[model samples]
Target: MLQYLNPSSAYEALLEFLAAGGNVLVVIMFVAFFMWALIIERIIFWTTAKDGVIKRAKRAWAARTDHKSWYAHAIRDRLISEAKQETERFNGIIRALVAVTPLLGLLGTVTGMVEVFDIMAVTGSSNARLMAGGISKATIPTMAGLVVSLSGLIFINAFERFAKKAEHEVSDELLIE
Candidate 1:
Protein backbone atom coordinates (compact mmCIF):
# COMPACT_ATOMS: atom_id res chain seq x y z
CA MET A 1 0.00 0.00 0.00
CA LEU A 2 1.24 3.46 -0.88
CA GLN A 3 1.17 6.21 1.74
CA TYR A 4 -0.33 9.45 0.41
CA LEU A 5 1.27 11.42 3.25
CA ASN A 6 4.79 10.52 2.19
CA PRO A 7 6.55 13.47 0.56
CA SER A 8 8.54 11.26 -1.81
CA SER A 9 5.42 9.51 -3.01
CA ALA A 10 3.61 12.81 -3.46
CA TYR A 11 6.51 14.19 -5.48
CA GLU A 12 6.58 11.05 -7.62
CA ALA A 13 2.86 11.36 -8.27
CA LEU A 14 3.25 15.00 -9.35
CA LEU A 15 6.03 13.99 -11.74
CA GLU A 16 3.86 11.30 -13.22
CA PHE A 17 0.98 13.75 -13.68
CA LEU A 18 3.28 16.20 -15.42
CA ALA A 19 4.76 13.50 -17.64
CA ALA A 20 1.31 12.35 -18.61
CA GLY A 21 0.38 15.98 -19.39
CA GLY A 22 3.34 16.82 -21.67
CA ASN A 23 4.83 20.30 -22.31
CA VAL A 24 1.56 22.09 -22.98
CA LEU A 25 0.44 21.43 -19.42
CA VAL A 26 3.36 23.55 -18.26
CA VAL A 27 2.05 26.46 -20.34
CA ILE A 28 -1.44 25.84 -18.96
CA MET A 29 -0.05 25.87 -15.44
CA PHE A 30 1.71 29.17 -16.04
CA VAL A 31 -1.39 30.77 -17.50
CA ALA A 32 -3.55 29.39 -14.71
CA PHE A 33 -1.18 30.67 -12.04
CA PHE A 34 -1.09 34.21 -13.43
CA MET A 35 -4.81 34.27 -14.06
CA TRP A 36 -5.53 33.31 -10.47
CA ALA A 37 -3.02 35.85 -9.25
CA LEU A 38 -4.71 38.60 -11.18
CA ILE A 39 -8.09 37.42 -9.96
CA ILE A 40 -6.97 37.52 -6.37
CA GLU A 41 -5.52 40.99 -6.88
CA ARG A 42 -8.80 42.19 -8.33
CA ILE A 43 -10.74 40.74 -5.43
CA ILE A 44 -8.41 42.44 -3.00
CA PHE A 45 -8.86 45.73 -4.78
CA TRP A 46 -12.60 45.35 -4.58
CA THR A 47 -12.36 44.75 -0.88
CA THR A 48 -9.86 47.47 -0.03
CA ALA A 49 -9.01 49.83 -2.90
CA LYS A 50 -12.58 50.23 -4.10
CA ASP A 51 -13.79 52.22 -1.10
CA GLY A 52 -10.78 54.52 -1.23
CA VAL A 53 -11.52 55.35 -4.85
CA ILE A 54 -15.13 56.10 -4.07
CA LYS A 55 -14.14 58.30 -1.17
CA ARG A 56 -11.67 60.24 -3.29
CA ALA A 57 -14.23 60.77 -6.02
CA LYS A 58 -16.75 61.95 -3.45
CA ARG A 59 -14.25 64.36 -1.98
CA ALA A 60 -13.40 65.78 -5.35
CA TRP A 61 -17.05 66.25 -6.20
CA ALA A 62 -17.77 67.78 -2.82
CA ALA A 63 -15.03 70.36 -3.37
CA ARG A 64 -16.60 71.64 -6.56
CA THR A 65 -18.83 74.71 -6.10
CA ASP A 66 -19.76 75.37 -9.73
CA HIS A 67 -22.87 73.41 -10.74
CA LYS A 68 -25.78 73.68 -13.31
CA SER A 69 -23.48 74.45 -16.22
CA TRP A 70 -22.41 72.46 -19.28
CA TYR A 71 -18.75 72.71 -18.27
CA ALA A 72 -19.48 71.43 -14.77
CA HIS A 73 -21.48 68.49 -16.18
CA ALA A 74 -18.60 67.58 -18.48
CA ILE A 75 -16.24 67.63 -15.54
CA ARG A 76 -18.54 65.34 -13.58
CA ASP A 77 -18.77 62.93 -16.51
CA ARG A 78 -15.00 62.92 -16.78
CA LEU A 79 -14.64 62.07 -13.12
CA ILE A 80 -17.11 59.22 -13.46
CA SER A 81 -15.35 57.97 -16.58
CA GLU A 82 -11.99 58.02 -14.86
CA ALA A 83 -13.32 56.10 -11.89
CA LYS A 84 -14.93 53.51 -14.19
CA GLN A 85 -11.72 53.08 -16.14
CA GLU A 86 -9.76 52.56 -12.95
CA THR A 87 -12.20 49.91 -11.85
CA GLU A 88 -11.95 48.21 -15.24
CA ARG A 89 -8.16 48.11 -15.49
CA PHE A 90 -6.57 44.71 -16.22
CA ASN A 91 -9.99 43.13 -16.79
CA GLY A 92 -9.50 42.59 -20.50
CA ILE A 93 -6.13 40.98 -19.86
CA ILE A 94 -7.70 38.62 -17.35
CA ARG A 95 -10.35 37.66 -19.87
CA ALA A 96 -7.69 37.05 -22.51
CA LEU A 97 -5.71 34.81 -20.18
CA VAL A 98 -8.83 32.82 -19.43
CA ALA A 99 -9.48 32.47 -23.15
CA VAL A 100 -5.95 31.28 -23.92
CA THR A 101 -5.88 28.50 -21.32
CA PRO A 102 -8.20 26.17 -23.20
CA LEU A 103 -6.32 26.67 -26.45
CA LEU A 104 -3.11 25.61 -24.72
CA GLY A 105 -4.87 22.52 -23.43
CA LEU A 106 -6.03 21.72 -26.97
CA LEU A 107 -2.48 22.05 -28.16
CA GLY A 108 -1.42 19.59 -25.46
CA THR A 109 -4.05 17.16 -26.69
CA VAL A 110 -2.73 17.37 -30.26
CA THR A 111 0.87 16.81 -29.17
CA GLY A 112 -0.10 13.85 -26.97
CA MET A 113 -2.04 12.28 -29.84
CA VAL A 114 0.94 12.73 -32.10
CA GLU A 115 3.13 10.97 -29.56
CA VAL A 116 0.70 8.07 -29.45
CA PHE A 117 0.71 7.89 -33.26
CA ASP A 118 4.47 7.91 -33.31
CA ILE A 119 4.61 5.06 -30.83
CA MET A 120 2.18 2.96 -32.88
CA ALA A 121 4.07 3.66 -36.09
CA VAL A 122 7.34 2.57 -34.54
CA THR A 123 6.16 -0.61 -32.80
CA GLY A 124 3.43 -1.59 -35.30
CA SER A 125 1.03 -2.57 -32.57
CA SER A 126 -2.27 -1.11 -31.24
CA ASN A 127 -1.62 -1.87 -27.60
CA ALA A 128 -4.23 -0.49 -25.14
CA ARG A 129 -1.89 -0.04 -22.20
CA LEU A 130 0.64 1.84 -24.28
CA MET A 131 -2.03 4.07 -25.80
CA ALA A 132 -3.66 4.81 -22.43
CA GLY A 133 -0.71 6.95 -21.26
CA GLY A 134 -1.00 9.10 -24.37
CA ILE A 135 -4.73 9.48 -23.88
CA SER A 136 -4.20 10.59 -20.28
CA LYS A 137 -1.64 13.13 -21.48
CA ALA A 138 -4.10 14.49 -24.00
CA THR A 139 -6.98 14.73 -21.52
CA ILE A 140 -5.21 15.98 -18.40
CA PRO A 141 -4.27 19.41 -19.72
CA THR A 142 -7.69 19.88 -21.29
CA MET A 143 -9.24 19.18 -17.90
CA ALA A 144 -6.78 21.49 -16.18
CA GLY A 145 -7.39 24.32 -18.65
CA LEU A 146 -11.15 24.03 -18.45
CA VAL A 147 -11.01 23.97 -14.67
CA VAL A 148 -8.83 27.07 -14.57
CA SER A 149 -11.01 28.97 -17.03
CA LEU A 150 -14.20 28.06 -15.23
CA SER A 151 -12.83 29.18 -11.88
CA GLY A 152 -11.67 32.47 -13.37
CA LEU A 153 -15.00 33.04 -15.04
CA ILE A 154 -16.76 33.43 -11.71
CA PHE A 155 -14.36 36.10 -10.48
CA ILE A 156 -14.41 37.96 -13.81
CA ASN A 157 -18.17 38.38 -13.66
CA ALA A 158 -18.03 39.42 -10.04
CA PHE A 159 -15.41 42.05 -10.84
CA GLU A 160 -17.53 43.49 -13.61
CA ARG A 161 -20.55 43.67 -11.36
CA PHE A 162 -18.52 45.34 -8.65
CA ALA A 163 -17.21 47.93 -11.09
CA LYS A 164 -20.63 48.68 -12.45
CA LYS A 165 -22.05 49.06 -8.98
CA ALA A 166 -19.20 51.29 -7.96
CA GLU A 167 -19.76 53.49 -10.97
CA HIS A 168 -23.42 53.81 -10.13
CA GLU A 169 -22.68 54.61 -6.51
CA VAL A 170 -20.09 57.23 -7.45
CA SER A 171 -22.38 58.78 -10.00
CA ASP A 172 -25.12 59.09 -7.41
CA GLU A 173 -22.70 60.73 -5.02
CA LEU A 174 -21.59 63.22 -7.63
CA LEU A 175 -25.22 64.40 -8.04
CA ILE A 176 -25.32 66.19 -11.38
CA GLU A 177 -27.30 69.43 -11.68
Candidate 2:
Protein backbone atom coordinates (compact mmCIF):
# COMPACT_ATOMS: atom_id res chain seq x y z
CA MET A 1 0.00 0.00 0.00
CA LEU A 2 1.31 3.43 -1.06
CA GLN A 3 0.12 6.56 0.68
CA TYR A 4 1.15 10.15 -0.02
CA LEU A 5 0.83 11.38 3.55
CA ASN A 6 2.69 14.60 2.66
CA PRO A 7 0.22 16.75 0.73
CA SER A 8 2.88 19.39 0.10
CA SER A 9 5.01 16.98 -1.90
CA ALA A 10 2.36 15.52 -4.19
CA TYR A 11 4.21 15.73 -7.49
CA GLU A 12 4.67 11.97 -7.41
CA ALA A 13 0.91 11.42 -7.40
CA LEU A 14 0.54 13.34 -10.65
CA LEU A 15 3.32 11.35 -12.23
CA GLU A 16 1.75 8.12 -11.02
CA PHE A 17 -1.71 8.97 -12.38
CA LEU A 18 -0.37 10.04 -15.75
CA ALA A 19 1.57 6.84 -15.86
CA ALA A 20 -1.69 4.99 -15.26
CA GLY A 21 -3.39 6.11 -18.47
CA GLY A 22 -4.85 9.33 -17.07
CA ASN A 23 -3.51 11.27 -20.03
CA VAL A 24 -6.92 10.77 -21.63
CA LEU A 25 -8.47 13.24 -19.23
CA VAL A 26 -6.01 15.89 -20.29
CA VAL A 27 -6.93 15.29 -23.90
CA ILE A 28 -10.63 15.53 -23.12
CA MET A 29 -10.15 18.84 -21.32
CA PHE A 30 -8.15 20.15 -24.24
CA VAL A 31 -10.96 19.36 -26.65
CA ALA A 32 -13.46 21.08 -24.38
CA PHE A 33 -11.29 24.18 -24.14
CA PHE A 34 -10.81 24.22 -27.89
CA MET A 35 -14.56 24.01 -28.51
CA TRP A 36 -15.21 26.71 -25.92
CA ALA A 37 -12.71 28.96 -27.66
CA LEU A 38 -14.42 28.36 -30.99
CA ILE A 39 -17.78 29.09 -29.43
CA ILE A 40 -16.53 32.43 -28.10
CA GLU A 41 -15.03 33.34 -31.45
CA ARG A 42 -18.28 32.51 -33.24
CA ILE A 43 -20.24 34.57 -30.73
CA ILE A 44 -17.99 37.54 -31.36
CA PHE A 45 -18.38 37.07 -35.08
CA TRP A 46 -22.17 36.91 -34.81
CA THR A 47 -22.21 40.12 -32.78
CA THR A 48 -20.03 41.91 -35.25
CA ALA A 49 -22.07 40.64 -38.17
CA LYS A 50 -25.31 41.78 -36.55
CA ASP A 51 -23.86 45.21 -35.93
CA GLY A 52 -22.75 45.52 -39.49
CA VAL A 53 -26.13 44.49 -40.85
CA ILE A 54 -27.94 46.89 -38.54
CA LYS A 55 -25.72 49.75 -39.55
CA ARG A 56 -26.33 49.01 -43.18
CA ALA A 57 -30.07 48.83 -42.64
CA LYS A 58 -30.07 52.12 -40.72
CA ARG A 59 -28.05 53.77 -43.47
CA ALA A 60 -30.39 52.46 -46.14
CA TRP A 61 -33.43 53.63 -44.19
CA ALA A 62 -31.89 57.06 -43.60
CA ALA A 63 -31.50 57.41 -47.36
CA ARG A 64 -27.74 57.28 -47.25
CA THR A 65 -28.17 54.95 -50.21
CA ASP A 66 -31.47 56.04 -51.62
CA HIS A 67 -33.52 53.18 -52.99
CA LYS A 68 -34.22 55.05 -56.22
CA SER A 69 -30.52 55.63 -56.83
CA TRP A 70 -29.57 52.08 -55.90
CA TYR A 71 -32.38 50.67 -57.96
CA ALA A 72 -31.26 52.72 -60.94
CA HIS A 73 -27.66 51.61 -60.45
CA ALA A 74 -28.71 48.01 -60.05
CA ILE A 75 -30.65 48.18 -63.28
CA ARG A 76 -27.71 49.73 -65.05
CA ASP A 77 -25.24 47.27 -63.54
CA ARG A 78 -27.62 44.33 -64.01
CA LEU A 79 -27.10 43.29 -60.36
CA ILE A 80 -30.79 43.21 -59.50
CA SER A 81 -30.97 39.56 -60.43
CA GLU A 82 -28.20 38.68 -57.97
CA ALA A 83 -29.58 40.58 -54.99
CA LYS A 84 -31.89 37.75 -53.96
CA GLN A 85 -29.05 35.23 -54.06
CA GLU A 86 -26.84 37.47 -51.94
CA THR A 87 -29.53 37.87 -49.31
CA GLU A 88 -30.12 34.11 -49.25
CA ARG A 89 -26.43 33.42 -48.82
CA PHE A 90 -26.13 35.80 -45.90
CA ASN A 91 -29.19 34.38 -44.16
CA GLY A 92 -27.98 30.83 -44.73
CA ILE A 93 -24.68 31.41 -42.95
CA ILE A 94 -26.47 32.87 -39.95
CA ARG A 95 -28.93 30.01 -39.72
CA ALA A 96 -26.35 27.29 -40.32
CA LEU A 97 -23.94 28.50 -37.65
CA VAL A 98 -26.76 28.84 -35.13
CA ALA A 99 -28.00 25.34 -35.86
CA VAL A 100 -24.64 23.58 -36.05
CA THR A 101 -23.47 24.11 -32.46
CA PRO A 102 -25.67 21.47 -30.91
CA LEU A 103 -24.45 19.05 -33.54
CA LEU A 104 -20.91 19.79 -32.42
CA GLY A 105 -21.84 18.97 -28.85
CA LEU A 106 -23.34 15.68 -29.95
CA LEU A 107 -20.15 14.90 -31.79
CA GLY A 108 -18.13 15.53 -28.68
CA THR A 109 -20.36 13.27 -26.60
CA VAL A 110 -20.04 10.45 -29.11
CA THR A 111 -16.28 10.83 -29.35
CA GLY A 112 -15.97 10.79 -25.58
CA MET A 113 -18.08 7.65 -25.29
CA VAL A 114 -15.90 5.94 -27.86
CA GLU A 115 -12.83 6.74 -25.79
CA VAL A 116 -14.49 5.42 -22.65
CA PHE A 117 -15.38 2.10 -24.25
CA ASP A 118 -11.91 1.78 -25.69
CA ILE A 119 -10.37 2.33 -22.28
CA MET A 120 -12.77 -0.11 -20.66
CA ALA A 121 -12.25 -2.90 -23.15
CA VAL A 122 -8.48 -2.75 -22.91
CA THR A 123 -8.29 -2.81 -19.14
CA GLY A 124 -11.09 -5.41 -18.72
CA SER A 125 -10.94 -4.42 -15.08
CA SER A 126 -14.19 -3.17 -13.64
CA ASN A 127 -11.98 -1.43 -11.14
CA ALA A 128 -14.12 1.54 -10.20
CA ARG A 129 -11.19 3.88 -9.73
CA LEU A 130 -9.67 3.22 -13.11
CA MET A 131 -12.97 3.13 -15.00
CA ALA A 132 -14.35 6.19 -13.27
CA GLY A 133 -11.48 8.31 -14.49
CA GLY A 134 -12.33 7.80 -18.13
CA ILE A 135 -16.05 8.14 -17.53
CA SER A 136 -15.55 11.38 -15.62
CA LYS A 137 -13.38 12.83 -18.36
CA ALA A 138 -15.93 11.75 -20.93
CA THR A 139 -18.68 13.57 -19.03
CA ILE A 140 -16.71 16.71 -18.17
CA PRO A 141 -16.01 17.46 -21.80
CA THR A 142 -19.68 16.89 -22.59
CA MET A 143 -20.75 19.33 -19.89
CA ALA A 144 -18.45 21.96 -21.29
CA GLY A 145 -19.67 21.32 -24.83
CA LEU A 146 -23.35 21.61 -23.88
CA VAL A 147 -22.79 24.82 -21.91
CA VAL A 148 -21.01 26.53 -24.76
CA SER A 149 -23.44 25.26 -27.40
CA LEU A 150 -26.54 26.30 -25.46
CA SER A 151 -25.23 29.77 -24.72
CA GLY A 152 -24.29 30.36 -28.33
CA LEU A 153 -27.58 28.93 -29.55
CA ILE A 154 -29.69 31.19 -27.36
CA PHE A 155 -27.63 34.25 -28.16
CA ILE A 156 -27.83 33.52 -31.85
CA ASN A 157 -31.61 33.04 -31.88
CA ALA A 158 -32.20 36.18 -29.85
CA PHE A 159 -29.89 38.20 -32.01
CA GLU A 160 -31.61 36.97 -35.12
CA ARG A 161 -35.05 37.85 -33.83
CA PHE A 162 -33.94 41.29 -32.70
CA ALA A 163 -32.18 41.96 -35.94
CA LYS A 164 -35.22 40.97 -37.95
CA LYS A 165 -37.53 43.18 -35.91
CA ALA A 166 -35.17 46.11 -36.10
CA GLU A 167 -34.75 45.68 -39.79
CA HIS A 168 -38.48 45.57 -40.38
CA GLU A 169 -39.11 48.66 -38.26
CA VAL A 170 -36.42 50.70 -39.89
CA SER A 171 -37.39 49.61 -43.37
CA ASP A 172 -41.08 50.25 -42.89
CA GLU A 173 -40.68 53.59 -41.16
CA LEU A 174 -38.07 55.13 -43.41
CA LEU A 175 -38.84 53.84 -46.89
CA ILE A 176 -39.61 56.84 -49.08
CA GLU A 177 -42.68 55.98 -51.10
Candidate 3:
Protein backbone atom coordinates (compact mmCIF):
# COMPACT_ATOMS: atom_id res chain seq x y z
CA MET A 1 0.00 0.00 0.00
CA LEU A 2 2.77 2.43 0.91
CA GLN A 3 4.92 1.49 -2.05
CA TYR A 4 2.10 2.00 -4.51
CA LEU A 5 1.51 5.51 -3.27
CA ASN A 6 5.25 6.31 -3.19
CA PRO A 7 5.77 4.93 -6.71
CA SER A 8 8.63 2.53 -5.85
CA SER A 9 10.89 5.14 -4.27
CA ALA A 10 12.58 3.55 -1.24
CA TYR A 11 13.12 6.84 0.59
CA GLU A 12 9.58 7.92 0.10
CA ALA A 13 8.34 4.56 1.19
CA LEU A 14 10.41 4.76 4.33
CA LEU A 15 9.07 8.17 5.12
CA GLU A 16 5.56 6.90 4.57
CA PHE A 17 6.27 3.90 6.75
CA LEU A 18 7.45 6.05 9.61
CA ALA A 19 4.67 8.53 9.18
CA ALA A 20 2.05 5.82 9.21
CA GLY A 21 3.73 3.96 12.05
CA GLY A 22 4.63 6.96 14.17
CA ASN A 23 2.19 6.71 17.03
CA VAL A 24 2.09 2.94 17.65
CA LEU A 25 5.77 2.27 16.95
CA VAL A 26 6.84 4.83 19.53
CA VAL A 27 6.46 2.28 22.33
CA ILE A 28 8.77 -0.13 20.54
CA MET A 29 11.35 2.60 20.03
CA PHE A 30 11.35 3.45 23.71
CA VAL A 31 11.83 -0.15 24.73
CA ALA A 32 14.60 -0.54 22.18
CA PHE A 33 16.41 2.48 23.56
CA PHE A 34 16.13 1.16 27.10
CA MET A 35 17.47 -2.22 26.05
CA TRP A 36 20.28 -0.57 24.09
CA ALA A 37 21.29 1.46 27.10
CA LEU A 38 21.38 -1.61 29.27
CA ILE A 39 23.49 -3.47 26.77
CA ILE A 40 26.00 -0.67 26.46
CA GLU A 41 26.14 -0.12 30.21
CA ARG A 42 26.79 -3.79 30.80
CA ILE A 43 29.52 -3.81 28.22
CA ILE A 44 31.34 -0.96 29.90
CA PHE A 45 30.60 -2.29 33.36
CA TRP A 46 31.72 -5.87 32.74
CA THR A 47 34.87 -4.70 31.04
CA THR A 48 35.76 -2.89 34.24
CA ALA A 49 34.35 -5.60 36.44
CA LYS A 50 36.66 -8.28 35.09
CA ASP A 51 39.70 -6.11 34.47
CA GLY A 52 41.43 -6.13 37.84
CA VAL A 53 39.15 -8.36 39.88
CA ILE A 54 41.03 -11.54 39.34
CA LYS A 55 44.42 -9.87 39.28
CA ARG A 56 43.49 -8.30 42.57
CA ALA A 57 42.34 -11.71 43.68
CA LYS A 58 45.64 -13.31 42.69
CA ARG A 59 47.58 -10.66 44.57
CA ALA A 60 45.35 -11.17 47.55
CA TRP A 61 45.84 -14.92 47.21
CA ALA A 62 49.62 -14.56 47.03
CA ALA A 63 49.34 -12.28 50.03
CA ARG A 64 47.34 -14.96 51.76
CA THR A 65 44.18 -12.84 52.08
CA ASP A 66 42.12 -15.84 50.85
CA HIS A 67 41.50 -14.39 47.40
CA LYS A 68 39.54 -17.34 46.07
CA SER A 69 36.33 -16.47 47.94
CA TRP A 70 36.31 -12.83 46.93
CA TYR A 71 37.60 -13.64 43.45
CA ALA A 72 34.89 -16.25 43.07
CA HIS A 73 32.17 -13.79 43.98
CA ALA A 74 33.55 -11.21 41.60
CA ILE A 75 33.81 -13.78 38.84
CA ARG A 76 30.31 -15.01 39.55
CA ASP A 77 29.01 -11.48 39.22
CA ARG A 78 30.84 -11.12 35.92
CA LEU A 79 29.29 -14.32 34.56
CA ILE A 80 32.54 -15.61 33.18
CA SER A 81 31.67 -18.89 31.49
CA GLU A 82 35.32 -20.02 31.30
CA ALA A 83 35.52 -20.42 35.03
CA LYS A 84 33.77 -23.21 36.92
CA GLN A 85 29.96 -23.19 37.14
CA GLU A 86 30.37 -21.00 40.19
CA THR A 87 31.53 -18.12 38.02
CA GLU A 88 28.42 -18.16 35.86
CA ARG A 89 25.92 -17.27 38.55
CA PHE A 90 24.97 -13.92 37.14
CA ASN A 91 23.61 -15.52 33.97
CA GLY A 92 20.27 -15.61 35.70
CA ILE A 93 19.99 -11.82 35.61
CA ILE A 94 20.54 -11.74 31.86
CA ARG A 95 18.09 -14.55 31.33
CA ALA A 96 15.56 -12.74 33.46
CA LEU A 97 16.01 -9.42 31.67
CA VAL A 98 15.72 -10.91 28.21
CA ALA A 99 12.85 -13.22 29.11
CA VAL A 100 10.76 -10.60 30.86
CA THR A 101 10.82 -8.05 28.04
CA PRO A 102 9.30 -10.44 25.54
CA LEU A 103 6.50 -11.28 27.93
CA LEU A 104 5.84 -7.57 28.30
CA GLY A 105 5.64 -7.35 24.53
CA LEU A 106 3.18 -10.21 24.62
CA LEU A 107 1.19 -8.31 27.19
CA GLY A 108 1.07 -5.36 24.83
CA THR A 109 -0.27 -7.68 22.18
CA VAL A 110 -3.04 -8.86 24.47
CA THR A 111 -4.06 -5.41 25.48
CA GLY A 112 -3.94 -4.22 21.90
CA MET A 113 -6.17 -7.10 20.86
CA VAL A 114 -8.61 -6.30 23.59
CA GLU A 115 -8.81 -2.77 22.27
CA VAL A 116 -9.26 -4.16 18.76
CA PHE A 117 -12.15 -6.29 19.95
CA ASP A 118 -13.70 -3.32 21.59
CA ILE A 119 -13.39 -1.45 18.33
CA MET A 120 -14.87 -4.39 16.47
CA ALA A 121 -17.84 -4.75 18.78
CA VAL A 122 -18.63 -1.12 18.37
CA THR A 123 -18.17 -1.02 14.60
CA GLY A 124 -18.96 -4.64 13.57
CA SER A 125 -16.58 -5.15 10.62
CA SER A 126 -13.00 -6.17 9.70
CA ASN A 127 -12.32 -3.09 7.67
CA ALA A 128 -8.61 -2.58 6.99
CA ARG A 129 -8.54 0.98 8.21
CA LEU A 130 -10.52 0.11 11.31
CA MET A 131 -8.48 -2.97 12.21
CA ALA A 132 -5.04 -1.55 11.40
CA GLY A 133 -4.75 0.41 14.62
CA GLY A 134 -5.24 -2.58 16.92
CA ILE A 135 -3.08 -4.89 14.85
CA SER A 136 -0.26 -2.37 14.72
CA LYS A 137 -0.35 -1.87 18.45
CA ALA A 138 -0.25 -5.61 19.02
CA THR A 139 2.55 -6.53 16.60
CA ILE A 140 4.83 -3.53 17.03
CA PRO A 141 5.44 -4.05 20.73
CA THR A 142 6.31 -7.72 20.26
CA MET A 143 8.81 -6.95 17.52
CA ALA A 144 10.36 -4.19 19.57
CA GLY A 145 10.60 -6.38 22.65
CA LEU A 146 12.19 -9.22 20.75
CA VAL A 147 14.69 -6.93 19.08
CA VAL A 148 15.73 -5.48 22.41
CA SER A 149 15.82 -8.85 24.15
CA LEU A 150 17.75 -10.64 21.43
CA SER A 151 20.32 -7.89 20.90
CA GLY A 152 20.89 -7.55 24.62
CA LEU A 153 21.25 -11.32 25.03
CA ILE A 154 23.81 -11.58 22.24
CA PHE A 155 26.00 -8.78 23.54
CA ILE A 156 25.74 -10.04 27.13
CA ASN A 157 26.76 -13.56 26.14
CA ALA A 158 29.72 -12.27 24.20
CA PHE A 159 30.76 -10.18 27.18
CA GLU A 160 30.41 -13.26 29.34
CA ARG A 161 32.96 -15.06 27.20
CA PHE A 162 35.44 -12.21 27.49
CA ALA A 163 34.87 -12.10 31.23
CA LYS A 164 35.64 -15.81 31.43
CA LYS A 165 39.11 -15.25 30.02
CA ALA A 166 39.78 -12.60 32.61
CA GLU A 167 38.48 -14.88 35.36
CA HIS A 168 40.68 -17.75 34.25
CA GLU A 169 43.73 -15.53 34.13
CA VAL A 170 43.07 -14.45 37.68
CA SER A 171 42.41 -17.96 38.86
CA ASP A 172 45.57 -19.34 37.29
CA GLU A 173 47.73 -16.54 38.61
CA LEU A 174 46.28 -16.92 42.09
CA LEU A 175 46.62 -20.69 42.50
CA ILE A 176 48.52 -21.66 45.61
CA GLU A 177 51.78 -23.61 45.54
Most lDDT-accurate candidate = 1
- On residues 1-177, what C-alpha lDDT tens digit does candidate 3 reach at each position? 565565558767655654444444555556556656666666666656555555555554455554357665564334333333433444556656677778767877787787789889999976778878877778867776787689778976886686676667755565443
> What does the lDDT read for residue 43 in candidate 3?
66
Give the lowest summed-lDDT range of ten residues in model 1: 1-10
Candidate 3 has a TM-score of: 0.64
| Candidate 3 or 1, higher lDDT | 1
> Taking the tens digit of each residue's C-alpha lDDT, what string does model 1 give over 63-103?
88986789889888888998999898889989998888888
Model 2 steric clash pairs: none
Evaluate all candidate structures by whole-model CA lDDT and list the values in order: 0.87, 0.50, 0.63
Ranking of all candidate structures by their lDDT, best first = 1, 3, 2
- Badly placed stretches (over 4 Å) of model 1 are 1-11
Q: Which stretches of candidate 3 lie over 4 Å from their true place?
A: 1-34, 46-49, 65-91
**Which of candidates 1 and 2 is the stronger one according to TM-score?**
1
Native-referenced Cα lDDT, model 3: 0.63
RMSD of each: 2.1, 8.3, 6.9
* Residue pairs with clashing backbones, model 3: none
Error (Å) of candidate 1 at residue 171 is 1.2
